[model samples]
Target: MPVDQPQPAPPVPPVLPADVELRSPRPEDAEAWSRFLVAAQRDTYGALLPAAFGDDDLAASRIAALESAFAEPGDAARRIAWRGSAVLGVASASAAPADWEVALGLVPAPASRELDRLYVHADAHGTGLGHVLFDAVVDERPHYLWLIDGNERASRFYERRGFRHLDERVSTGPSWGHIPMHRMLRG
Candidate 1:
């Protein structure tokens, strides 16, 4: 079974509440942002990969990762959707001159951007946070990102936005029981 999966939820709405604010990550936000990522991962992947949740090493790794992503004030250029003080969603992409990562062979493309990650809390799912976050780093052009195979709803959402699945796939790291994930691309 896949280790990283989100439970079923209603479709995301096209509109977001007016109070929702979209912006980039701030330096001081490291701690809250780390908590949000961990919580988000747990909410999405807990059921699929229960063992990973109990692994303190994995939890620390995730936190350290966010710290690295937010290491510099403007390093990753991460964007966030916030509702007042709480984080609603997050999105980010690497610099262009890109190469999409795959399991067997790399999906190479010149100057094609790639989505690093995009996640929205389930509570904010129907509030258009996904779309808001996605649009921050992606338009309708060519790009790709890996999606956990078990996250059908997210895969469908990517499909709705014109991302098509490639034939290749990969797995989560060793601790994840080698769950499969599909690579989706848009052009």
Candidate 2:
């Protein structure tokens, strides 16, 4: 069966429940955040992006990227969703950087922003943390993000929020055996 591609519509705001607390990433969350990052990627890709899963590769990649990003804070905002002390999800955005669009082979207009990451721990699925985290970061502004190829759940999420893809796939990055990924843009 063929799936419908994303199309433009009004942004669908996330309905975050009160218990799903939202906060800025703290210095103390480094260790937990790293673990959360790996777990989230493993679950997301193992379940969605790949034809087959490799746990070790995803773990290694997460270690490499998380360490490098948190080593020095730069122009970025990270929003964390939590239930009590456990981090449910994480989302972030930095000043639109050169080559990021190029990396994803996307060219956002000067008015757009790049949503760096939006990840929710696998266990939080269906609890709506993903929507909450997304709301905290992007919230339907003129923005673009790389969507892993074949990620139907995420595709539907953004599609519902009016994000449309550029119809180009970039075989890029280390995650999911460097899967074919594409950029989704919305204004």
Candidate 3:
């Protein structure tokens, strides 16, 4: 008789902390949202960005922009993940604009949506916050997003969520240190 071989256990899915809350962006969250976004970006892409990217002026500018956006009526649907008073992550989506389709050489679809921003604080990684935030902003419809060229972690996350890369790559311009990013799409 042959001995039985050991079997490996299946991977466990991450769970969101019970206390965490996911909600729409509010005017009062502007400062927290801006700070969280900048910190998350620095943690994930500081090395790939220019020195000026970490300057106080840039942070202040981001805060101002977020404040204005939060106060204004906008097309984007945004969600912020929070744990008590702290922001844990954010995600946003909007209908793809005509200009964006033209630039990407993509045929316009009425249901096409753009995943604008999805950032999670480093502390929230592996806690399922990112997945929750993503699902909160987007659904099973066709949507697309741009991923930074070298962010392997994010690439893996998106790939596992069914996003596939396109041949097109674009520069983010001077504001983002001219970083190259590629487009990914999912239906």
Candidate 4:
């Protein structure tokens, strides 16, 4: 007979409500934003390794990329939800690369906009920030995103927010497996 180990206690629920002030991300937000994103990604997905390209150092790289992208020429925007000095979530959309479709899909065309990323702290989950962020992104640009299949929560979230499925092709990431879902968001 073997003894079983006890499971860890669940995270404490957030006292903060869903109502958060949304504003543009500032350079000052880089540190906390990087920390939040790194921890969130690690908690949600075991480890981060995209084709041996992304590792533990990926978070810093992502932060740098985000900073650069936001500062680059052309229309780019980032919204951060905040409760005082604390950052609750972030959402961003940008003009997609001309070659995005060719690289990711059988069809090749230009995308008006693409949802680059959206992340809400786990403490803030179920607090309506996700919906808020989604709405902000949609309001900023008329576009769609290609969500990888294994992310059921995200797919369901998008579906609930009015995104429609466009394809069912499978694609693989480094550490993650096949993800088969193409979705479009329309008014």
lDDT of each: 0.71, 0.71, 0.80, 0.64
lDDT of 4 by residue, 1-187 (tens): 9899999997553343545678777666766666666555556555433443324435677677756655562576577888877778878777664354557553542247777668888887788788777666666345677766567788788777667766556454434434344545644
* Ranking 3 against 4 by lDDT, winner: 3
For candidate 1, write residues 1-187 as lDDT tens digits: 8698888998654666789878777755666676676678778877676565535533666657656667663434478777889888878877543332434345453226677678898888866778878877786557777788778889888999888888866776565556787678788
- The regions of model 2 sitting more than 4 angstroms off are 1-19, 47-75, 98-111
Per residue, candidate 2 scores C-alpha lDDT tens digits across 1-187 of 8999988997565577787778887666666776676677777776444553444434656656655666555866678777788888889876674464556545544335777778887677777777777777775457777788888988998887678887787775554577788778778
Ranking of predictions according to TM-score: 3, 1, 2, 4
TM-score of 3: 0.78
- Please say which candidate is ahead in TM-score: 1 or 2: 1
Q: Candidate 1, after superposition: displacement of residue 55 in Å?
A: 6.5
Worst 10 residues of 2 by lDDT: 49-58
lDDT for model 2, on a 0 to 1 scale? 0.71
- How do these models rank on lDDT, best leading? 3, 2, 1, 4
Candidate 3 C-alpha lDDT tens digits along 103-133 = 7565653347888789998887887888888
Model 1: ten consecutive residues of lowest lDDT: 96-105
- Model 3 misplacement above 4 A: 1-15, 54-65, 71-74, 98-111
